[model samples]
Each structure stands twice: as C-alpha cells, then as structure tokens.
Target: MFEFLLNEEQRKLRDEVRELVAWVPRQLILDMDQDKVTFPKEFLAEAGRRNLMGCRYPRKWGGRGLDWVSTCMVMEEVGVLGYIFACVFGVGAELVCDAIIQHGNDEQKERYVKPLLAGEIFAAECLTEPRGGSDFFGTTSVAEDQGDHFLLNGQKRFIVGAEGADYFLVYARTDPDPKADPRQALTCFIVNRGPGVEVAYLYGLMGCRGGGAGRLVFKDVKVPKANVVGSVGGAYKVFNTMMIPERLGTAAMTIGAAQPAVDVATGYSTRRKAFGQPINQFQGVSFQVAQAVTLLDASRAMIYATARAVDAGEDQNHTRRLISQTKKFVTESCQQAAHHAMQVMGGIGYTNVFPVERIVRDLRLASIWTGTNEVMSMIVAHEWYRAYHQAKTSAPRDFEADALEAESGEKIYE
Candidate 1:
C-alpha cells in the first residue's frame, strides 16, 4: 500500500501531532516542570478530538486502526512536547488501552477501551509495589474472590496518572502457589477508585513531576467479577504482552526528549560568541552536537524498526529481544545525548533559561521507567545467549571456516 517506510497517511498523522506541539504554549511545558500543572486533561481532550489517542487500536473502538510504527511516530512527536505529556498519553493509550483491547472481554472493552481511546476518562496501571520494583510477579497485592465481586487489598506506589485516572488496571495474587513459579501466581483485575481506594501519597519528584504520581492503597475494595482481564491466573501473559508497547513507546518518546536539547545546544553554539567567533566553530562543541544528533537518529531508527516488528506480529522472543535492546541502548544513548547537549551550552544549559537542564532531568527517567536499564541488559543477554545456542545446535553454519582453519594454531579450546 506504501513505498517508503512511512506511508502517506502516517506522514499526515505525524504532521498532526507536530502541529499540536506548535499549538501548545511553551509556558505550559515550563509550568508542568515547576509543578504548577496537575493534569493535561485539556490536551488529552484535544488529542482525542484529533483522533490521535489510539493510533494502533481498532476504529470501532474510537481508534484509527494504524500500525505500531505509526504509533511510535506519533509518540516521538508527542515526546517533543514534554516527557509528562508523552508519558500520560503513552500510559493511557499504549499501556492501558492496548491491554483492554487484547485481554478485556467484549463488555469490558466496550466499557473501558472505547471511552479510554476517546479520552472520556483516564486510566492507570497499578504495578510496582513499595517492596518490589522490577519484580512484577512478586506483587504483594491480593484480590480475594467474594462471590459476585473480588475484594482487592494492598497498595501500589509510584503509579503515574494515579491522581487523575478513573479506572485502574491492577494485578493481585488470587491463588498463591508457594511451590509454583511467581509468574503464574497472580491475576489481573480492572478496578475503579471507589470506597476503600485511597491515594495515600503524592511523591515530590525531581523530574517528570506532573500527572500526580502517587501511592494507591486498596483496602477491601470491591470489584465486579466481570472486571477481570484475561484468565484468573494469566497476569504474567498480559504483563509480558504489554511490555512491547510499554518499553518501545518509552524509548521512542526519549528520542523526542533527547533531540530538543541537541537542537538547543546546536543553536546556542551557533549564536553564543567566544574568542570573537561562534562556539560551534570549535570542534569541542561541534563534536558534542554531532554525537548527540547521532544518538538521536540511531535511537529513532531502532525504536521504529522494533515497532514495525511488533506490528508484523513477529515471534515473541524476537520482538522482546529487539524491544529490550531499544529500551536499554536508546535510553542510555539519549541520556548521554542530553548530557552532551548540556555540556555544549555550558552555564546557560544548566539554568532553566535553556531547556537542556529540564531535558537532563527528564531524560534521566527514561532509563529508570518502564523497566530499569539493568533489567533490559539482563533480557538482552539472556535472549542473545538463547539465539546463539540455538544457532550453534539447531542450525549450525560456519561462515568463517577458512579463516579458522588457516589460523588453527590459535584455536586453543582443546
């Protein structure tokens, strides 16, 4: 249907989001960083009006039915706006909306995803307890089946969009199996913030401060039996399934966040004079710009490539391997780009007058959120080992046989 990597329609969608970035006042972005903004409901409503909320979802559910790569493109553009906005949009559409579309039953889909994609209400994913960080399967939350309803208990902290979300996608231990793997011991539920659901604390964050990240305590909260997502003990599957969008989306947005700082630094270097010439004339400053831009471009390429793989319904292992690579490599690379951009600008970059300071604060979270870079490294190494062993055992091929034979004396494994 299309010749280039992005089709005509996808290009237009990117334009739409780019137009949004132009329309939104820069002051709003600054205000969010200062903790003056609570939520971006107005922006969310405008995004829904433009039909940009759920690019990869079905049209019947108020989505455009676009591909995952298109969603990545849009997120990258949205990321240009600010990290909080990009994160709010990504969590609602990619994380929560996609989960409901895949695992929610007919009624649940009609109830949640439809309105969710329309921006009629907000949603939050309740994972990550105080004790467990990346160990999702070790969740301390428990949901007991109470006849027609489930009594949910326990608390989730550091949840983004917790203060404004109307619904929650929660995971809890339904039937704990001590001897069984923790992966299969939990269940997923959709809960509403009603009686017994409390917003315990709002964290004073160093960056990405808006959207009210907080602690949610569920004390004997009642959720209808129909609210369960997927099977009773199928949360592991749902979590694994959602990781693609979660990590990939985060990576794409980080690309956007990384670029603005580079642009700022480059522009500053061109204008800021030192020794009767522009600072950009110096290799010291220019190379930083070059490195930053290279990282940004590389991060973008990997994110969209992995996103296309996701759209193609690639093998789960392969998709996760690429996604982990993108998350780890791209995030760290972007974080470095941000730092370089700041260094290029010197003192002004460290101040709020320029955006590099804010970008440095924001980009730091990219490696920490969705999953830590350490976790991503573990996944990449594990997947690499699996593929390496498989190729050696199942589909062995010696591409360097001549070189190895010619250098036989160097082979000392025996």
Candidate 2:
C-alpha cells in the first residue's frame, strides 16, 4: 500500500535520476575531494538541463513545479551517489529556491531565483555563527541601518558552498532594543559575497569534503535596503518555515545513503565465504542485516509521512516534531548501517578502494550537521510537551459530573 503512493511518473523520475547518477563515475567524486575542487559547476549545469535543480519550484521561475514527493525522490537518488552532490542540491533547492519562491520580491526573484534555477549561480545560507549555531537567537552578527542601505558585520562559520556561492541569505541583528524578543531582533538579507565579505575554506573535515564548508567574514558589508528578504525583522518566521522542508529533505537523503549501504553489505555477506560457507548463512551476520533493513525502512516511512504533512500544510507543529524525529532516526540509522556495511566487508571495507568507507565517514557528519541529533531530540521533546498541554486544554470536560457520580457511589460507565 505504501509503495502505491509512488505513481508511474514518480517512479520514472526516480529511475531516470538513478541512471544519471550511476554514470557519474565514482572516481569523479573521489577526485573532487582529493583536489579540493570548487563546486562542480559543469555537473550543476547538467542537473539544470535535466530540470533536477528546481524539482519542487513553480514553473514560472524556470522550475518543473513538481510536488514535494518528487523533490524527495530526486534527493534520495543524489544522496545515494554521495553526500557532496546531495548537500549541494539540497542547499540550492530548499534554502535558495524555496526562499525566493516564497519571499523574494519580483526583482529579487528575477535576479537570484531565475539564475539559481538555471544553475548559473549557486547560493548559501549564513545563519550559523562561531558562537551562535545551536542557539541562533544569541547571534552577534549586527546590521546597522545606513538610510538607503545596511552595514553587515560578523563572522559565519560552517557555511556550505561558501567558496562558490553567488549570493547568501544572511541573518543579522537589526534591532538592538534590549526589550525586543531575540527572534524579532534579527533580519534576513540577500547579500552578495563581494567587497567587504571574505570567504575562507575550512580544510580537513571528517567528510563531505567535496562540498566546501567554510568560514565567511563580513566587515561592514554594504547591503541595499531592497536586499531584505521578506519583511525586515521577519527572519525568525522564515527560519521556522524553512526547517520543515530542510529536515524532511535531509531524512530523504539519509534513507538514500543508508539503503545503498544495506544492499552493499547484504550482497557481500551472501557472496563472501567464511568457515566454508557463505557469511550470510551465519545467524549473526543475517541478524545484523535484518536490523539494518528494519531501521532503514522505519526511518523511510517516518520521513515520507513528514514530507506528506508538509506538502498538505497540515498540523505544522506536528510536522516539525515528526521531521526532527525522522531526521535523528534516519541519520543515526544511516551511520549505523554504514558501520555494518564496513564490518561485514572486513578489511576491504576500510580501504579507500571501497566506497563504503567513504560513505561511512560522510554519514558521520549527518548526525552533526542539520541540527545535530541531540538538538533534534530536544526539539521533539519540547513539541511533545506543547502538544500534550494543548490536548489537555482542549479535551472535553465532564470532571465535575464524574466526580459527583463517583462520590455518590454510582457506577460511571463509558
């Protein structure tokens, strides 16, 4: 029944994307990382030609105007190939394209969104600062009003695609009113990384090396007032709205990466001999594979359900909680799945010669980035509390009547 949700059209899209990624040549991914390559502009151009760059955006802006399911399918396929490609497209589609489609002005949309969709330019988000990543409300980035423009000054670390990004959706504090809520104090701006902005590469990360995550410094960068995204002091709303798709997209990627690891490990177990028999014949190995599949499938279902909710625009709070839970589950499952894949393959799995080793390293970062699993747990718990309280308050009340009947020694029946 769940499989039925994917129609013929969706299935075709998935298969086509899978084939495209399959021909990417594994050595290319390795070579990109080895050389510290800039964002693969040519590869992105090919993706644009395929219409994969704007899978969920409206067709008016050079997009295909497909549903969220199609977007998830495309992400899953890219993720299976490698996290580098997945991260690039994720930032492009979710953070960049979605923002422009939802909030950018007519001029802003034409200049940024159109080119982004056409793969002529790449975009990045500048939210996480050195001191205020998990606690975004405590950001120190300040923007001073200069009449017709604003002066942005601060540093952002761990900015993905910084080296090649044509523009950035940067968050800065515009209101310094001590009484103002932190959420209301900040503003979002579309800043071109030139003049006063400096991008420095962060070398030697654990994985996802192909996608450049760097430190971005802003020294009184002049941003036009017109560059503001949405309304001034409305960044918190934008951030909250964006999280749903971001987390759901991440979950899709986790499923994609994990599934391949499971398949690789299972195939190896069946073919490799141990004690004069197939390793897969051993109950221990088989059980591990079973556990991996079970977790992966469960995570996939959770992710899909969350994505469906987002598409329908129903129960946003519930969707956010589910997205957080799904991201944590899927990312942790993928990491474990990658570990199992390597364990089953023994020495061969650890060598650079094998893809699993690289995948395992890449998956390790998933648990760290995209609001670390620890943060996801906190978000889920907080939402659960809020939901519980809302339910308690809205629940039908017959407490007085029930108490009186019980006190009078009368039976209370449902």
Candidate 3:
C-alpha cells in the first residue's frame, strides 16, 4: 500500500508560488501569445530576485540548493499558472543552468550558468531535430572542429524558447564513425545564436501557446572549442541525466493541469442541478470525479517518490524506471481526467469559455512530447520484466501488519 504526502516545506513553497502567480491575470497569457512576445524579461528578473529561477541547482552556481522534490513542487505551481512563467524560468534554469553546473568548465559555468541564474540571459536545449525527435541518436546535425572553433550545420525543430534564447545547448555528431555506437557519436556544444543561425517561430500550436517554440537553422554557426559541454562524445550520458529531471518535472506539470480540471468539474457537478438535484448526487458523475481524484493522487505519489529517489542518490536504473512509469501513468491519467472533466461539465466544457477545454489540449501534448506514452509503456514493461526475472527465484514472504492494514483500507497496492 502507498500514500501521497507533501512535507511542510513543500506545502509552503506551493502556497507561495501559487500566491505569487495568482497576480498574473490569465488574460496576460493570452495577450502575450497574441503579440508574439519574446521572453518576459522583467517578470523573469523579478523571479530571479526571489531565487525562483535557481531552485534545483547548487547555491555555488547561483541556485537555491534545493532537492528535486522541492523543485517538482515549484514546477507544478508554475505549470498551474500556465506555461509563460514556467517556460521562461524552467527551461532556462533547469535544462541549461543545471547542464552547465554538471558538465561546463569553470569558464563556461561562470559565463552561462551565473548569468542565467540571475535571469540576465535565456537558454535553450536543442536536441530535437527536423529529422528526429525521440531518435536523438540518429541526429543529422553535424559539428566540425577547426582548431579554434567548431562549425555547426543542421536544423533543430520544436526548440522551446528558441526565439528568445541567448544560448543553445546544441547536440550534434562530432564523430562519424559508422562502426561506433550511435549514442556515443553524438556530442554537445554551447553555441551562441549569432551569424548563420536562424530562428523561426512555430506559430499556432494546439496548446502551450504561451511558450515560445520554434525551428532553428544553423548554417555553419561557429562555436568556440571551449564551449563544449562534458566530454566530446558524451551526449548520451548528458541526455540520460537531463531526462530524469525533465520527466519528473513533466509529471508535476500534468498533475497541476489535471487538478484544476478536476476541481472545476467537481465544483460544477456539486452545484448544477439535474432532475431536481445536484448533478454530483448522481452515481455516474460522482464516480467519474472519484476516479479522477484517485488517479491524480496516485500519479503525484509516484512522481514525488521518483524525485526523492534521484535526490537521495539511489540506483540510477531504478530511478529511471520509476520516472518512466510515473510519466506514462500521469500523462495518460491526466488525459483521461480531462476527458471526464469535460463530460461532467457538459456543453460548457466544450467551449473556450471554460478552462477544461484548454487543459485537455495541453495534457494531450504531455503524452506526445518528452517521449511518447507508447515509448514509456515499452520501457516500463521492459524494466518490470527484468526486475521480476531477477527476483523470481527468491521465496515469497508474508506481508507486514502495516501493509495488511493499509491494503484493507482500500489504498492502491504497490
């Protein structure tokens, strides 16, 4: 049996973030999107002053030195507000600042991580290409070394914050050894967006329209030799490390998005009268709300548990498996919850006037991006099978008294 819980600090952080973000009117998000806005530098600078931009990294690198769980809570609150503030600070700080802290040299860290933490600059993680998304190892982006610098030539698609990004953590193939492992062939470079680098906006997205995502075309864009992150051909490891946090953060985002829909539906059902009674008094609608709440709570538990494991420096393989399962479960559950929410809201949910419609569209992208739900399911199945096989020979043991008590209380079984 399992339980979903949040500590005092996490609760406080969530409250604070929610209070701060509440000041940002929803119409501002629509306005920003309509204006084709670049990053909101002023708002980000305010966030920087509050230390929100550096929530997960070490204090030495201008971060808050918090654990991954705290970071997840912060991300969830931001996601609840919408993608505008979250996208600006989340991608800039988590993906890029953390990458530099982990792999950048002293000079690189000082140049990129510090300023980014101060919200003086924006960064983008460029992994997806026009030719590949999940198949990042098959990237056709190439970077050629020329003594003092590397010339990058390729096109990246679906790059978040590309239009406003001052720096890009670009992944490219530096070695073309056909016999070498595909994953090992890929390398990463921190290239400034300058001459020969073109950024094109990806307008009219189905959802997450507040976030700036676009295509980047690099035509022999020159990068200094010192700008390489980690080892020359070590992108696989970097990618793996980066994804752990990314998936965990995504889970939090889904929970944030879904919870609102669930709340709205619950409120509507309890008040809207049908057949001379509140709609929620009906079994069908009540059951749907119950199921949605259960799934959301369960998903939050898995996500927090996985984040805690990573922060504790537990086994990487186990953590990755947990992360994959959490992402798959949460994203799928969110979509289902959104659908039920719409169903409960009836005709009102179908209109743009209600937020449930937008939430449904937003949650759809969660399943598709950051590795598809199909891919996550395959990974989860593989890991479960491996673990089962490895432990199958052991004898079974009796459950503890607490386990029995919890199980008998109708809690979900592990």
Candidate 4:
C-alpha cells in the first residue's frame, strides 16, 4: 500500500485484511495494552477462518499458496492495528508454521500446520531463554535423550502466546557433551501445553502486552521422539530457515503500524493552528511530516525488493543480507517516523487521546525484537565481506592500483 503496485490478487488480499483490521475491536487493543488480556486468540482465529494466516504455504495445508510478496502485503495491512496485534498475529504463520512446513514430517504437518493455519490452534516459538535470547547458542535449556523420549528441563522467557499457545516450537540443547559444536548441539521440538509445561509468570511489559508474553518453565517435560521437527541435534538449519519469514514479516507489518502515526500527524496539522495559520504551514511541523513520509517511502522500497528477492529464489547469502538490511533499516526508519509524528502533534500526541503516543511506545519494540538491529548490522557486514571476496576471484580491475600512492611503497602495516 505504501508504494508497491499490487496486481488484482494482491489488492484483493490487502482489502480483505483491511476489513479484518477494521473489524478488530478497539477495546481489545486497549485491554491488551492495559494487561487485562493474556492472549488475543480471537484475532488469530478469525484470520485463520479467512485463510489469511499463512498465504505462502500450499493450499492443501490451509494456505493460499501465494508468494512471499503477497504475504507481506497482508502483513502491511494488519500492522495498522498496532505492534502487539501485529506481533502476536504473525507468530503462528510466520515463525511457527514456517518451521513445520519446511522441516516437520508429514504427520507433524498434518497435526500441527494444518490445524495451526486453520486457526484451530495457537503457536509460539521459544527461542529466547532466561540467560538471554541474543546469545542463542548459549542455550541453557537442555532436553536429555531418554530412549523413547527426551526430558525437557529448563525455562524460556519472553515467549509470546506462552499462556495460550496450543504448542511451542522449542529450541533446546540436545547434545550432552558441553564441548559439542553449538550449531550442531541443538534441536527443535514441538512441545505441547501439558504435564510439566507451565506458564510460570506473565511479565508486565512497557508495551506490546496481551499476547501472553511470559516465562515458560518446563520441568522434566517428556516429549516423544516423533515431536522433533528436524534431525536430532540439528536445530540450526530450522532456526535459520524460519528467520527469513520472521524478519521479513515483521518488517512489512511495521509499515502499517508506523504509517498511521504519520498520517494522523499530517491530518492534525491541516487543522491544528499556531499563530493564526495551520500548523502544516510551519516548517517545523511540515518538515517533520515530509521527513516521515520520505523515510516510510524508503522503507517500502527496501521491503518490497527484499520480498521479491525471496520470492524469486535469489542467492541465499544475498537474500539473507537483503532480509537483515530490510529488517534493520525499515524498523529504524518506522520508529523515527513515529517519533516525527509525535513531535509534530506536540503535547496532545504525548497523551492517550491521540493514538500517536501508543504508536510510539509500540513501535519502540520493533527495532529490539526479531533479532536486534545491531545483530542485523553484524549479519549485513559479515555477508557483504564474504560476498565481496567470493565474487573477487572473477577477473576485474583493481581500483586500488589507480591510486597515486599505489607505487610509493609507503603504505605501512602492522
């Protein structure tokens, strides 16, 4: 909607989501923000009913069998509701559903993926832990191999849908040897809510509440061997594959969440007056609106290109770089755009009467989650260097030789 010219199918999907978002009760959003609700199950159930949950998967699996771009289009429209709605809305389809669709056995898919996309069940991905999510390989949560089953014993914190998820796609260290390679030492398991699984505590968050973010304690939870999504001690592949949609979907949804703030500020300025003229006449307000729109436009381009790249099956490394870059750039840009909206609205924007303040609080988490923007930068730089060196083997001009100092032999090195 920002700038991507959609085909008839894409436009139709967008309209459908717009109607769905319009249908969401405003009180539900407020209640969730105020910590009055644990999970927004109603929203997901409705989206699933419309067959809009995971548009990219096969229709046989309850998806539209659409491409990634179409899915992003859906996310962008859903995002306008707010961050909490956007985050929880995507957990099932983007993160949990994708993993099973890609790696789970046919039985697992039929049992989990079908019901999940059908909105018959809620799902959450347990990646972050008590120690921290950033140090993913530094997982303390262990699942001991117990012949017929694995005994999962540990805790996962900040898990959305912890209170209401029908099951969790948990990543736990499966290898007993401490010296095992971290990448190969882990595994993914679909742990259902039962027995020793407990939602120990629900955190009172600064924002983005009501999706049931909480601490999940698993005490000797017995999981059948068949529940393992991928190979034994092979969660790295699954995690990487899931992140493509994880980051891309978040980036797209955020566009809708952030755009409204800018639009609200723009509309307010047209009527808001300072010194007998509309606030839009002043550079202070108009410039902020101008800047926010520009940033939004820039973000749209990056998200659209990256989504297309993913759909077209471009190079893996290149696509990953684009994903990380889009995730980092779009989030940061949207955050700033919301800030501009707040600044433009001045005092009233700070209060809850206008949605700008809520937008600001909600948008703050976008840059932090889905892997921090800092992590995105690290991945981008790492990939760029690797790609640059790999492509350098082809015959090409050495621009360094053109520098006048090339023959001076004055270049010093450590």
Candidate 5:
C-alpha cells in the first residue's frame, strides 16, 4: 500500500538511521537532559564516520548525495532521540550545510561543508538578534566592509550551537540604508570563531536543552571578503531558499518526536488498569490513542509529500506554500499528539519515568522555531488567497454547477 512513498534504498536508509540511533544509550539521553550540557561531540563524530551526516548533499562533499525524502527519513530517526540530538545534528547538516551549498563559493564549500559533513567542525546559523525574534530583516547586526574584510559587531541570541560551533553562517545589515528594501539590505557571511567572537550567555530552556542554546556576541570580528556568501545584497535569496530545507526538516523531526509518544502511550494504556479494566478498554482513553495515532500518520504523510515535492523540483512558491503548511500542521499535530499521550498515560506520563513529558516539552519548540506557527499560517493564507484570486480569473465557471440550484453569479449578493 505504501510502495509509492519510499523505495527499497530509502527503506534501507531509514533502517540504517534507526540502527545508528539505537547506539545512543537511554542513560546518556537522560543525563544530557538533566545536565543541560552540550551533546556529546563523540556521538556526532561517529555519525560522520558512518557517512550519515549530510544525506542530501553531494557525495563529493562527504554527504550521501541522497534526496530530500532520504534526509527527512534520517531526521525523523534522530528526532526520536529527542530535541537536543535533532538540534545538534540539524545545526550542521540542515541549516548550515544548505546555506553553504547554495551560496558559498567553491573554496568556502571546501573550507566549511567538507569538514562539517565529516564532523571535524561544528557550525551554526546566527540569525536571531537580541531584539529580533521572527523578524529576519529587522536584524541589528552590522558587517562593515573594510577593503579586504568586513568587521562584524552584533549580538545574536538563541543560537543552537553557539557554545561549540567552530564557525557561524552569520547574517548582518551590510547596506545600512534605511530607505533601502529590507530584503536587499542584508548579507550573509562565514565568520570563524576567534578572539572577537564569544558565546556570551546560555539559555535555560523549558524542554529543548543540551544543544548549547546560547547567545553569540561578535566584537569587531574580522571576516574576509572571500567569506561573503552569494553576494553583498543577495542574502534575501539565500535565506528564502534555505527556508525550504529548514521547514521540511523540522516537520520530519516533529514526526519522529511524536511517534514514540504514541508508542509509549499505547503500551501503557493497554496494560494499566482503571475501574477494573485496562485503560485502553475505556472509550475516553482509546479515543485519545486513536487520535494520537491519526495525528502521527497524518503528519508523516504530509511531511513526506512535501519532501517529495521538493525532490521533484516543483514550483518554488508552490513548494514553499506546501512546506509552510506541512511545518505548521505537523508540528502542531505532534504537540497535540504528545499532549493526548500524556493524558492517556495518567500521572506517570508527566514524570521523567515516561518520555511523553519530555516529548511535550520538545515538540513545543517545533512550532516556535523554524518560524512560528503564526508565521506559517500567514504564508499559507497568503499563497492560498493568491491562488484563489487567480483561479477566478483563469478558470471561472468552466463547468456547469453540479448541485447549485441557479447560476453562481445569480446566487451571489450584489
């Protein structure tokens, strides 16, 4: 029934990732969660050694050269490990690599992508400033050109890999023209961490921790002109293009975090007794289980469909619309599924004894990060409205009404 979704090679790849995740001990996961420390670099190095770091990039750059669907599959498995693991891997593999592959020059690619995919170095995207939350263009970071180099000075907060990243794919206001288009005013650069760059402060998160969430302060950091990605005034394009992989990857990870929540809830419900019977025997609990399962399956389907559309090189705007919708729907659904799982498992679900509580905390960030669910809704609404208006002009009433009693125009108000 599902033959059309993933082929033999993809299935094998999924199994391979599952095996890789199996090597991650539950104790280590729990320890990391409790300590709120950095993800074990050794674990990431092992993933690189196994050639599982960049599944979508070309094999020449140390990746598997796989498709978006394959990358999503790997993301889903890593997601099951929890938010920290997903965030750590994602900083290098999805966020940074996509930008470098798209905008970096050949030398830039060799300097960053190869070592990143090989796990020799870590990377992070420095986008969110101290003031700007979801507003990418409102960034206050400035990169002043100094003949051969740019002196960067800014503070970026909520950077996932700030504490450990060897370098950052940083964005700054290069034009500094107040009247200029905000989209054209920004620029991207590859900034190495050195004397002028510092991990300023670490954030204590509610759920998603252990991925080195911190603030990065660039104090007159000198980045060479050769490090400019794409062009001085073309970062908007790079940022927008990177959104595709970012949103799709987040959606896939949502599925991963949600599936295990459903599994744990289901197992517990079937065994735990309530009112002289198993909790699963109760309609209230059973219905919640059914809903959780439905959400998981539906989320998986939407994410893969979006991934396939990306792989097929569908229309950029149309694919973006689908990507936004997938990220919004899947992340929200995963959050809801985790909530339902917690309810089904009763009080114990709220404790660390079960993974459901942690899933709840982890999935909350999925909607907030990558862009808020509200932002996703805005994109979906805008695209849908555009298509709605165009359909009226292009395909207006081409067919006879099937159920209407009168002409469509006649039925409408003046």
Candidate 6:
C-alpha cells in the first residue's frame, strides 16, 4: 500500500528476493518442520550463490552494499518460507557479519565475513547461557588469556544453527575482577567448532525447527588471540550494534510469515460454505480477516518507516526506541494476525492439512526471541519518559494550560 516509499533499486531487490523464495521446494519446508534436516545448507548455499544473503554489507564482502530497507525486504521475502530459514540466513548475513564488518579487522573479514555471506559456511551467535538469556552483561563464560591464545570455557544455550555451524561468534568475560563493569568486562571472539567445541544437545521445539538449534559446550577451547572482535574490553559497543539488526530483522520477517496465513484464511472463507453461503459472507468471519489484514499492513508500514529512519542515521536514542517499538509491536501484531487466521479457518486451520497451523507455531516465537516484548516495552517506556523532560524547554505548547483549571494546584507536588 505504501510502496511509493521504496526506490527503483529497492523494488528491484525485492523482486530478486521473491524469485529466490519462489525457488524453494516444498519438501525442504516440510522436512525442516519435522526435524528431519538439521540445517538447510543447500538452501543457504544457493542464496549465497545468488548474492542474496547479506544485502546490506558492502559489495567487497560478497554483499550488494544495499541499505537497511533493502535488507529488510530480503528478510521479509525469505520469511515467507519460515522463521528458521530467515534466521539461519541472517545469523550469518547480518547478525554475525555486522560485528565483523564494523569491528573485526580486514583479515578477520576475509576469514569469516566473506565466506559466510557467500554461503560457503555457516555461523551462529552465542550470547545466552544457563544463567540467563537477556542478561547480556551478566555473562559467566570466561576466556582466560594465555599469551599466545585464550582458553575459552563456557556453555551457551539455544544457539540456532549450532549443529551445522562451521564457527560461532562467542562472548565471554575476560576480566578477573568480579566488580568490573559488564560493558568493560567481556570480549567477543570468532570461535570455530573443533576439538573441544561440542553441539551438546539439539532441542525438540514445537516450531521454528530444523536449523540445528542446540546447546554448545566450549571446554578448554584454545582460541587464538587474533580472533578477538573489536577491542579486548569493548564488546558492549559490539553487542549494542548487533541488536539493531536483530530486532529490526525479526520484525520485518514476521510480516512475511503472517501475511500468508491471512491469505490462506481469507481464501478459505470464500470457498468454504455455511448455511448455503460462503463463510466469508458472515460478518464474524470477514471481520477477523479484516483485522488480520489491517494488522499486517500496519506492521509493514511501521517497519518501512523505522527502516528508513535507521538508514538516515537519526538520533541514536530515538532510533533505539523506534527499533524497539518496531520489534515489539510488529511481532505481537503479526502473531495476533496469525492467530486470527487460524480462527477463521476453524477445524481445518487447527490441522496439518493447512499451512496456517505451522505458521502459527513459527510466529509464536517472534514476541519471545530477539529480546522479549516485555523487555521491548520497558525500553520504549523508559525512552519516552526520558525524552519527556525535554518538553519543558518549549514554552509555546503548554498542554496543561488548555485545561479548565490551568494551575490545577500545580499538580500538588511539582
């Protein structure tokens, strides 16, 4: 509906991504859902071969050097397939690559970033642990410096692509001081899966399966000093940078997943009969479809605006809030849309005979991962109030003055 915001090149990129998505076979999606495939290496390799993995990275690193909007476009199109596909695609293309492109030296880029985008290998991020998932600063994994190398010993949980990942982007506490600031206490590394690295156990998930989601155990793994990303103690900045793509990408892909569910429901209503009339002819059924479509369009529009704001490099604090809003709102809205779609289809939707059930399971995780929606709301509320005090600087718009009792007893305390 708001396609005008996209440029010619961006539209072209969208079409290219659509083609790639269309090329996917039905068996792959079914197998991945059934947990028959650990990782869709062949699919990712094909995407890399087509140069569709990292649309935002520079062309020098096998990416097309596109903008965020373009990248989100890729994410959304790929998302139509499922969450696992877009995730494995982005873990290497953006999440892992962003750290290297922004912090890792050229040598590290050549060794890790280039091949990952090209689909020659796969990469995964290790930030969550047995102790916590969202508590980034409270990391317990420690890497002891050993002059020539660092012995990294820790376990990360719920690492997607862990089973098939050629290497991992791991974060561990490097400082010995227990009181040290979390922002200054840790370091990031590109840890390859070798001798001491183990894919401890794969999870049995209800949805978003197949991409080798599992636990990782790193025991006395010798990581060369050269594998450090950014500075030794500046991983906080790297972690912050990685979150932008994480939330924004998740929000964008969710739009793709939800749209198809709505389509299936709407289409089914037209053919399915009730009392000699099409089911959609009933207000109850049509209204649900309307609400689902509205939620989807709204989600897409928010993503478009937020992606543009990010590309323009708006105020860092404001951009952060907007990204959080995008993630929280879009994920929730899309999940609701899928739920509505399921409702519209009645008995059929609840069964495997239709794809809506599968999509519902995949969309269920959107609000929980990439920072929970609860966490997102906290950021939004905090940012809004922090910016609230700035309103006093302007004397013209005295909203309180418009009230019947202008003074209002000065709010009793202020």
The lDDT values for all models are: 0.86, 0.81, 0.79, 0.91, 0.86, 0.91
Which digits, one per residue and each the tens of the lDDT, describe model 6 over residues 300-370?
89998999999999988899999999999999999999999999999899999999999999988899888
- How does candidate 5 fare on TM-score? 0.95
Task: Name the regions of candidate 2 deviating beyond 4 angstroms.
Answer: 1-3, 393-414
lDDT of 3 by residue, 1-414 (tens): 121356676676667776767766666666655645645666666667666776777777787777888887887777776544565667778877777788778898889988888877878889888777988788899998888999899999987788778889999999977678877888888989799889865757777765568899999898988898998898887888888766777777778777789899999998999899999999999999998888887877887888888889987667778889998888888789888899999999988777888778777788877788788888888888887777766738533444646557666558
Better of 2 and 5 by lDDT: 5
Candidate 2 TM-score to native: 0.92
Looking at model 4, the pairs that clash are: none
For model 6, the local distance difference test gives 0.91
Worst 10 residues of 2 by lDDT: 398-407
lDDT of 2 by residue, 76-123 (tens): 888887777788888876777677678778898888888887878889
Work out the TM-score per prediction: 0.95, 0.92, 0.90, 0.97, 0.95, 0.98
C-alpha-based local distance difference test score of model 1: 0.86
Q: Which stretches of candidate 5 lie over 4 Å from their true place?
A: 1-4, 396-414
Better of 2 and 3 by TM-score: 2
Candidate 1 clashing pairs, residues 3+ apart or interchain: none
Judged by TM-score relative to the true structure, which candidate is superior, 3 or 5? 5
Q: Estimate, for each residue in 1-414, the C-alpha lDDT of model 5 and write its tens digit.
A: 133677898888777788889988777787777754565677677777777888889888888778988888888888898867877888788888889898888898899999888888888888888897789989889999899999999999999888888889999999977888998999999999897999889888888777778999999999999999999978899999989878888888888878889899999998999789998999999999999888888888898888889999998778989999999999999999999999998899999888889889888899998899899999999998887777776775655466666565667556
Tell me the lDDT of candidate 3: 0.79
Stretches off by above 4 angstroms in model 4 are: 2-4, 403-406
Highest TM-score against the true fold, candidate: 6
TM-score of 3: 0.90
- 86 in model 3: Cα distance from truth in Å? 3.5
lDDT of 3 at 38: 49
